[model samples]
Target: MTLFFAIVALAFAAVIFMQQPKFGKMPTGDRLERIKRSPNYKNGAFQNLSPTPSFTDGANFFTVMREFFFGGDPRIKPTDTIPHVETDLRNLPIDEQVLIWFGHSSYFMQVDGKRILVDPVLSGGASPLSFTTRSFAGTDAYAVSDLPPIDYLFITHDHWDHLDHETLKKLRSTVKAVICPLGVGAHLEYWDYDPAIIHEEDWNQTIALDDHFMAYTTPARHFSGRGFRRNQTLWTSYVLQTPSMRIFIGGDSGYDSHFAEIGRTFGGFDLAILENGQYNKSWRHIHTMPDEVLRAAADLKAKNVFPVHSSKFPLATHAWDEPLIKIVQAAEKTDLRLLTPMIGQVVHLDDSTQVFSHWWEGVN
Candidate 1:
C-alpha cells in the first residue's frame, strides 16, 4: 500500500512539473508608466469588491472527474458545424454597418467603413490543455484567415476565452490598434504586438476614434487572472458611442448598481450586448444569471438586448440551452427586445425588419 501511494504521489508531482507556467511578469518602462499616470487611469472597481460566492462548488471537482473518467450527461449538443460563409468585403460597399456574432463574446462589427473585431477567439479549445473538452458545437464559421484588415481589435479582459494568445499572434500585423482594459496591453505586448499601438483604458475613460465614434471602458463586477494571482489586471465592459448610435458591450459582469449608473451617464443605449451564460449560484457575484441579464438591460434602458458568452464553452454545470431559454423568457416578461442571431449571421443596426430566429434550436 505504501509503494502504491508513493507511485501515485510521484505521478501527481510529474503532472505539476510538466504543466506550463500560466503567467509571467509584463514588461515595464517609461511608456507603461506614462499610461499608468494618465488622468484617465482609474483603479479597477471590481478588485476591491467583497468576494462573492465561488462559481464552482466542492462537488464540481468530483463531477468533472467522473465525467472525465466516465462520460456523463450527453445532453449538451454540438455547436453550429456549418462551414462559415466567407463574403467579399471589397465587393460590398463599406458604408453599411453590420454586426456578426461569432459565438461566445466575439463579434465582427463593421461601422462607418471601418471594421472592428471584439473578443475574437478562434482556437480549438479554451483550456490550457489541448485534450480537454471544447465548444459543444464546432465553429465552422470563419477562421482568422477569413478576416479582412481590422481597424481595431477590442478586448474586455484576459480570460482564455476573451484573450487568446495564439489568435493575437496571428492578428498582430493585420490589426491596426489593440484596445483593452488597463494592464491587458501587457499580455498583447508579451505576445509581440507593437507596444505603441496597444491602447489601455481604465473604467470611465473614453478613447475617441473620431467625431462620430468613441469607446469607453466601463466597470464590470468581475475578477481577472490567467493563473493563481487574481486581479493583477483589470476587466471592463465597454460603451461605444457614435453620433448616430450608442452600444453597450457588457463583457462579463454580475448584477450591480453600475448598470443603472451607466444608463444615467449615457442617457440609455440603442443596444446592449451582455454576457448571458456560464452562470452558477456559487459565483453569482461574478457572473449574472439569465434573469439578471434581462434586469441589466432594463437598468441600461437599452432598446434592444443581445445575449452572448454562451454557445462556446461548457464552463458551467447547467444544461447548454438553459441560458438562452431563460433569457428569452425573461425578456418577454420584462418587455425588452431580445435579439437572437445565428452564429455567423449578420445584424444590421439601422434595420429592425429582420427576425430574431431561434438558431440554436436545431443545433442544441
Candidate 2:
C-alpha cells in the first residue's frame, strides 16, 4: 500500500515538473484555429504524408523501451571529446557565403547576403533538464552570444533538441524573423516572441524572404509533439532558393516517396542538409536508416549532402560514429559528394569542390 502511494506521488510530481516553461504550451485560441485549418492537420493532430507507424514490425513499446534504456550498442558515446573547429561567425565579411555546423541538427548559414540559423540548440543539452541528453563534449562550441544578429531563424519543429527554450529565449532579441512549420509558433509566442515576426506555414506553401530569396515549406514523413499528446504540430523540410543557390533543409523524416516528389518539384539542390544519425531499426519508419541516407540524397538530386543529426546527443543506441562510417562507404560507391566536416568547421558554400576530412576516423 505504501509503495503504491509513493509511485503515485512520484508520477504526480513529474506531471507538475513538466508544466514548467521549457516544456512549452500547445497551440490555443487563434493558434489552434489556424492549425485546424491546415491540410496536414487531421483527427485532432498533424498527420504525415505516408502512414508512418511509431515502430517497425516485431518492435513493440515494451521491447523498444527495454533495448533503448538498458540494452543496445555498447559505444553509445565517443571516448574522446568530439573534434571541432571554432570560428567567429559574425566577424566574417557580410558578403561571404559560408555555413558552420554546431553539431547535430543545428547549423548557421551566411549565404546570399543573409544570416540564417537553423535549430540552434547550443544550450549544452537537448532536454528540459540539463543533465539528461547532455551534448557530447567539445560540441558545445558556441553559445547564443556567439551568433551574429540573425536575419532569419528557422525552426524545423518543436522537439526539445531542435527547439530549445533556453536557446530560443537568448536568440529572441537578435532574430529579425522566425519562420517555422505550422503550429510551432505557439511555443515562440509562449516564450514572449513578437508574434508579428513569426511566420508559420503549411506544407507546399512558399514565403518570399525579400525579392531574392524564396522559402518553401515542404513535407517530411515524421510526427511531432513535445508532451505525451503527439502530433500536435507539423514536422517539415524546406527548400530555399537564393539568388545563386538552392538549398534543402530536411528537418527530419523517414525514407519515403516524398524525397523523389520534392526532387521532382524543386528539380535539384546545390546543398541538401539531411538527418543521418541517431537511428535504430525499431523506429525506422520515422528516422532514416544508415544506407537510406545516401539513397535519399540521390533521390533529391542534390549536388552535395551535408548530414547532420548526429555526434551531439545520444538520442539512439547506434555506435556514435556508425552514421559517418557507413554513409561514407556508401558515398564512395556513388558520384554524389558527401560533406562531413567536424563539429564547428567552416563549410565554404561557394566552394563545391572543397574537401572535408574524414574527421570521425581517429576519434574514439
Candidate 3:
C-alpha cells in the first residue's frame, strides 16, 4: 500500500505546516462583535474608502503570478550593497526630536519626548518564510536589540510585511503600548502580547497618547490580511499631533480623496511620511506610484515629505532604485520640501535648514 502511505505522509505534513505560529489566530467573541459594528465593515470584511480591486482591469492573479515568476526584469533587485548610516538610537538626545529610518517601512522617531516606532518589519524579511522577501544587501541594519524601550508602537495593518510575527515576538518586552487598526490585536494577542497594552481603533477615531501627544486614526485606500483571507482587519493611516509638530503617518495608501480630506480636517501637517514604493501597474489601487506620492503630499498640504516603502525589499517588478529616482523627479516639479535620509541616519524634526546627501547616487 505505497500509495496509502504517501497520502498519510502528505496529510501529516499539511497539518504540521498549518500549525506554524506565524499564521496567527483570527478575532472572535467581543473582538469580532466590535469589528462588525464598524461603519466600514460590510459583507464580512472591511471596506476601503472607495471601491478598490486587488488587481487592475485585465490583470488577473494567474497572469500576474506568471509575469512575476517568468517575465520580470532581472535588475528588480540591486547588485551592490546598499549604503546606510548607523546611528545609535538609544543615546540620541531626548530633548531633540528626530527620526531614524530602518529601511522599508520601519522607522524610529522621538517627538516631544515620546519615542515612536512604526510598522517595523526588522527581521530581515517580509514574508512568513525567512527565505522569501529578504531585505536587500545592507538594508537589514537594525535588529530588536538596537532599539531602546519604545513608548508607542504603531501598526497600520496585519500584512506580513508590516506586522511581522518574529519582530513583534522579540519586541514584546520593549513595547510599552501598541496602536493598530481594528482586529489586528488578535495577532498580537496570539503571539503572547498583553491585551491590556494593545489598543485597537477604527477609522476617524482619536486617542490621547499623553498630555502632549495625540493620535488620530485616518482612512487609507488599502486592504489588510496575513493569510489566504483578505481585508478582515481595517487598514489605516494616522495623524500624530504633538505639542509642536503635526505629522501624517501614512501607512500605505493608493491615490484617493482621503488625503485632502485629512488635510482640511487637521489644517495640514508639518511632516508627512508617505508610501512610495513596491508598486505595480497591475495592483496600482493598493499602493502608490511615484507620481501619485507627490500628488498625495500636495493633497495633504504637507510642508515637508519623506517618501519611504523603498530600498529594502524587491516586492515589485521595478528596479530597486526606480522609486527614488522617479520620486526625486516628481518632487522637482513642486515647491514641497522632500526629505531623503539614508537608513539609520538621523533626521532633525524641527530643523528647517537640515539637508541630507543624495546617498542613493553611486550605488549599484
RMSD of candidates 1 onward, in order: 4.2, 1.1, 2.0
lDDT of 2 by residue, 1-364 (tens): 9999999999999899999999988889988998899888888989988888899978999998899889968888888999899898879898888999999999999988899999999998888777799998899988999999998899999898899999999999999999998889889999999999998989999898877989999999888888888999888999999998999999888999999999999999999999999888899989998789878888999999999999999999888999998889988899988889987788998887899998888888
Clashing residue pairs in candidate 2 (N, C-alpha, C atoms within 3 angstroms): none
Tell me how many residue pairs clash in candidate 3.
0
For lDDT, candidate 1 versus 3, the one ahead is 3
Ranking by TM-score: 2, 3, 1
Clashing pairs in 1: 54-282, 78-136, 78-137, 79-136, 79-137
On residues 54-121, what C-alpha lDDT tens digit does candidate 3 reach at each position? 89968999989998888777878888999989898989888988999999888999988889999998
Q: Kindly report which residue stretches of model 2 are placed more than 4 angstroms away from their true locations once superposed.
A: 1-4
lDDT of each: 0.76, 0.90, 0.91
**Model 1 agreement with the true structure over 194-303: per-residue lDDT tens digits:** 97887787787889876687888888888777765566577889998766789998998899899999999999998899999877765677899898998899999999
Clash pairs, model 3 backbone: none
TM-score of 3: 0.96
